[model samples]
Target: MRLTTIGFDADDTLWQNEQFFRVTEERFADLLTDYAESKHLKQRLLEAEMRNLKLYGFGIKGFTLSMIETALDVTAGKVPTSTIATIMEIGRELLQHPIEPLAHAAETLETLSGRYRLVLVTKGDLFDQERKLAQSGLGDFFDGVEIVSDKTVETYVRVFNRHGDGPDKSMMVGNSLKSDVIPAIRAGGWGVFVPHALTWAFEREEPPVNEPRFREVPDLGALATVLAEIEST
Candidate 1:
């Protein structure tokens, strides 16, 4: 089927995102250096994030809370209030970090905007995602926006159906194979993996082997060509 809609993942796919989180994590490790070794601290923080995902969901607020939780755990509930305040301040800074569109992001979106239905299907803190999109200067290109809590097969099916034709006639492009590619493919859409350096471990997964609908590009610069090939197939 001809591709009618294209769904793009926002963070790390179109703009710099996970890099901020990596920096914050480094600062977090430094904060708890006296309590635990850097490796142990990072492991504990990852555990806290995983455990809290159900309660906190994704985004800076949840990450801040996870840092606090990790700090308290490592310190036996004795982590100083001042350190907690510092983490909160850094988290706030992260929330306000400037949105730098990736190389070729804008041009690629613009190239495909008029020809195909473009939808921003990202998962994060709704207000923060909205703020980033507003600041990104790319929001006007999208025919629809979906700041979802998570991406799943059902999510893609519903989003593509609502915004364009349907999943079979849609393509999802993003940095994480686990969330952005695999599920979209399972929903009967084309899944294009555009990798990023700082992807969260939880979002990493081996690409589907021998999958006719799965494609991977080094960056968004090569995306238009891939789309063209997919359409021809």
Candidate 2:
């Protein structure tokens, strides 16, 4: 199979992302500890994000502000203005978060860029993704960058079509099973599941559901090996 279009997921797949979110969450917990329990705050935030996804779409800046807004409303001035300021500072830090790629990210991209039609099929806050791409030095490797609201069946279908719809000749490599694996398979494309050693809790848990065209690997470096073998066949 000549792999014509190769799609990649950006977060934990290419660079460090959930780590930044984890750090920010820890800070957020500290700020709201006085108002609500940490667990309650976490649950409420998830609920709020799911609810807000309809309105704001997706992005870290909007999510962060929504969390703060929820805190303000839930606490009713008990969370001190300084805590809000601290959360804003944390948001700025997340925006400027260090963007180092995975162990073999650069070398792997370097090896494959000329060999395949590379596209970054990642889902996230558009502004956050743009920042990470600009900083990581790997952005230029992709022929196109897809900043999607969500990676659903339609997203994968659009990707395959945009790249001329040779689903069997295309493959998606990424860490998240929910966003990266199932959708690609649903679109009749191959999906490679690269498990991140320490993924954010939300991105970590997913049901396998016995998808035949899916393959699993430890991480992106391993993915490069898998793709090379696929090419050889």
Candidate 3:
């Protein structure tokens, strides 16, 4: 049967998300290196975020601020006023990061919208993803947008059935193996892993090496071609 619905992952999948986080983290590492190594600082920051998920939700802005707060508290007044200023500056730079769309993303979305029902299934801060969709102007391309709090097998099954004709006819495409591809595939939906060079460390994951149905595409533009083939077959 021809594919009727397609689901896409936002963030690094559609635009540059992790790159902004990485740049800010490097600046964070530089400033906190005196008090603690980058590795130590990152680990502590992860722990703090785990503790703050309910309090702050998600976003590079809040996460970076939490990292700075943790670093100062970790060192007991040794993180210094200057380092604090630098960290805030880095956070500002991060917020200012121009949301660059992935290669052929806009074109591909426009092309595919003509033929298939496309839904953007992304997990992150609600405000951030909404802002991104408004900025990219690709929001209109999707039949719907699922700003999930978390991406899991159950979520995929629910979303696919709710949005698509069924899991068998829906296709999920994104950069993350864990968040995008695996969950949807395991839910009995078709999945395409569109890899980005700068995937988030947490989002980075490997797919089953020899799954005949699983595909790894280079970018969104190629996605249109893939869909065409699927529809033909």
Candidate 4:
């Protein structure tokens, strides 16, 4: 692989993200238990979130709205005003939560930054993503940052054109097979999947079964070793 640029997925790949969402979701379910069963509530919330994606894009604000909509739906428009207030509080707390980088995340980025053009490519609410990136302390290591609405093969091509030579010389490192890996490979780039234990269900997809440029490592700590091997051969 003759990789000259490396793109990174910000949320689960660089820091602890989905874990917070999972915690907040559990709290959301608990908050509405009196109105509906936990399993049913979860299913409803997921459905709402998926449905709202096109309308609200992606982020905490949209999630907050979805939670409110689900709460209303579950209770047939009778969910208490107090419960609505608490759900808003949940969204506020999540927005203010500290950004905790994964173990070895900074170290790995520092190691790779000097060797390649590092770009942070992630999709979400622009303001929230920008806030998290500022708080992460690893922002200085990246040559560019692309906060996109979605990750697709065309998106990868556009990002590479803006930051690097092209897709063939670029590599994407991320947690989601759907957003980060498959699309990058389809765009003619190398893709390194660093699986996170707690992935959101919507981001899950079957791995590329036999793609030569597709690679998977246990975590960010193993990335340098993988790159070194790739460079040696």
Residues 1-233, candidate 1: write the lDDT tens digits. 78999999999999999989989889988988899999899999999999998899998999999999999999999999999999999999999999999999999999998999999999989999999999999999999999988898999999999998989999999999999999999999999999898889999999997899999999998999998787777
Whole-model lDDT values for every prediction: 0.93, 0.80, 0.80, 0.93
Among residues 3 or more apart in sequence or in different chains, the pairs in candidate 2 whose N, CA or C atoms overlap within 3 Å are: 59-125
Order by lDDT, highest first: 1, 4, 3, 2
Clash counts for the predictions, in order? 0, 1, 0, 0
Q: Write one digit per residue (lDDT tens) for candidate 3, span 1-233.
A: 77788899988888988877876777777777777788887788777877776677667666866877787777886777777777777776666677789888888888888688889998777877788889887888999999987888898888888888888788899989988888888888888998888865566677855764588788877886777777777
Listing every candidate in turn, what is its Cα RMSD in Å to the true structure after a full C-alpha superposition? 0.8, 2.1, 2.4, 1.0
Better of 2 and 4 by TM-score: 4
The clash number for model 1 is 0
Candidate 2 segments whose C-alpha is farther than 4 A from its true place:
76-78, 201-209
TM-score of 1: 0.98
Candidates' TM-scores? 0.98, 0.90, 0.87, 0.97
